[model samples]
Target: MTHIRGEVLIRRPVEEVFDFVADQRNEPTYNPDMVFSERVSTGPIGVGSRFRAAVGSGRRPVEMRIEYTAFDRPHLIASTTTMAAAEFSGTLTFKSTPAGTVLRWSWQVRPKGALRLMGPVFGPIGSRREQRTWARLRDHLEAAAKPPLRPGPVPTRFRRAATSHPPAA
Candidate 1:
């Protein structure tokens, strides 16, 4: 068993952070190791929502199924993930702060099959990988938060003269 814990401060609203992280499909945007992620269940994303994802692990891509066990909008989310070699269950807590939002994660990982023999070796590696992944999320959110530049009023000199009809043809 490996227990991994980490936190990251994101300069964004609690609701925004919570919603982005709640949707597993967004993982590939920030987590490079996540090759692909897709929602498998129907309806809105919340408790009981399921997802199918493939993540690059070692030499091959490991496929996993994730399911939400608990969901509290703008506050908390918990889920369990099962893969070929391991199982992970975790909770993400979101808290509002003057600076923005604080996201914390706590996960319990259990290795299965032949991988169980390497449990001690994976604890530290998993911790570091998770930390790096969330840090990228912070960068992604902060960068994405910037509003796109809107076109300014056209300069008077550059504006084409407006006419209701063609001038005298």
Candidate 2:
């Protein structure tokens, strides 16, 4: 088994961060390696919710089925993913921080079939990938938290045009 861990402090409230991370549909937005992800189970997200994701690209893309095993809103979430030659289980814990929310994530991967022999080589690669994923997550969340810039005030002509036509009521 190989273990990978990473943490990030996102400048967003705990509930907002948790909600964003809990939804599998948001994976591709942060994870560059993920090609696409979608919820497979119906209804609100919680324990037992399932998702299917395609990661990587080209001919060797990996298809994974992920299932939520634990869900504690604004606190913790755990999930497991089954791939062709390996199984992955991960837990993400959220804590309120003075600055925002601290997200700590850890995962264990167990290789099967032919992957067992390559575990030594893949372990480090997986660890680096995990770290990069978290960094991207932080960047994405923080960027989203910033308010968009406003245009230097509406043009006088446009503003007057809007007020010129009173409500038809």
CA RMSD of each candidate after superposition: 5.3, 6.1
Off by over 4 Å in 1: 147-169
User: Per-residue CA lDDT of candidate 1, range 1-169, in tens?
Assistant: 9899999999999999999999999999999999999999999999999999999978988899999999999999999999988999999999999999999999999999999999998889988999999999999999998999999998776665644347885
lDDT of 2 by residue, 93-156 (tens): 9999989999998889999998899878767888788888878888898898799998798889
Question: What's the number of clashes in each of the models?
Answer: 0, 0
Best by lDDT: 1
Error of 2 at 89 (Å): 0.7
